[model samples]
Target: MCEANAYLIEGDDKNLIMEAVDTIEPDGDNLLICNIFGEQKVVKASIHSLSLVDHKIYLKG
Candidate 1:
């Protein structure tokens, strides 16, 4: 329940990147995201904002 959904922010749009992300780690210029299902992804984006109350993680690419 503590896991958050990840989104990518570009201009005035938001794109859902991952659902139920368990972790977000900084690796050079990329953001590594891992989900509850053990799926993982590395994106070239930085954290833009977090909406913990809504269980969301926003990133800027």
Candidate 2:
């Protein structure tokens, strides 16, 4: 199974915005993420550095 999570660092706080996710992308000031339930989430990108691994976005501090 392919399980994933979205983690972001904002200022001095690190947060886990979601779990069991699928994909993520950079959209303007936010990161667009697709959850395991096929739901779309738009979160602020100011918190962390977004990295693309094997075409998947991994948000890191």
Candidate 3:
């Protein structure tokens, strides 16, 4: 279904911030997101890198 999950990294801890994300867009030190159910969310953080492998979104710092 091409559904993606968003995760936020905190030191040595990782947290699942959002799920069923339709897409992700970076804006400065934040992220603009559109969810599967047609919901929008904004996260304030610094994005290190973005990759898609096997239809999964990996946010790494």
Candidate 4:
């Protein structure tokens, strides 16, 4: 329940990258995101901002 949704921000647009993200780890130059359901993703992006109240994690590539 404490998990957050991940978003990829580009310009003025924000795109949903992952949902119910449980963990995020650094993997070389990329980032590894894991969901509550065991789904995983590797994104070549950097963290932009976090909206804890909204449970959102924003990233920029």
Q: Give the candidate number with the greatest TM-score.
A: 4
Question: Higher-TM-score candidate among 3 and 4?
Answer: 4
Tens digits of per-residue lDDT for model 1 on 1-61?
Answer: 8999999998898999999999999999998999999999999999989998899999998
Off by over 4 Å in 4: none
lDDT of each: 0.94, 0.64, 0.70, 0.94
RMSD of each: 0.7, 4.5, 2.7, 0.7
Residue 25 accuracy (lDDT) in model 2: 72
Off by over 4 Å in 2: 46-61
Candidate 2 to truth, TM: 0.59
Clashing pairs in 2: 9-47, 10-47
- Pairs that collide, model 4: none
Writing each residue's lDDT as its tens digit, candidate 4 over 3-61 gives 99999998999999999999999899899999999999999998889997899999998
Q: Scored by Cα lDDT, where does model 2 land?
A: 0.64
Candidate 3: give its CA RMSD in angstroms: 2.7
Off by over 4 Å in 3: 49-61
Quote each prediction's TM-score. Answer: 0.94, 0.59, 0.67, 0.95
lDDT of 3 by residue, 1-61 (tens): 7776777777886677777878778877778878889888778865554444543454554
Worst 10 residues of 3 by lDDT: 49-58
Rank order by TM-score, top first?
4, 1, 3, 2
Which 10-residue window of candidate 1 scores lowest in summed lDDT?
8-17
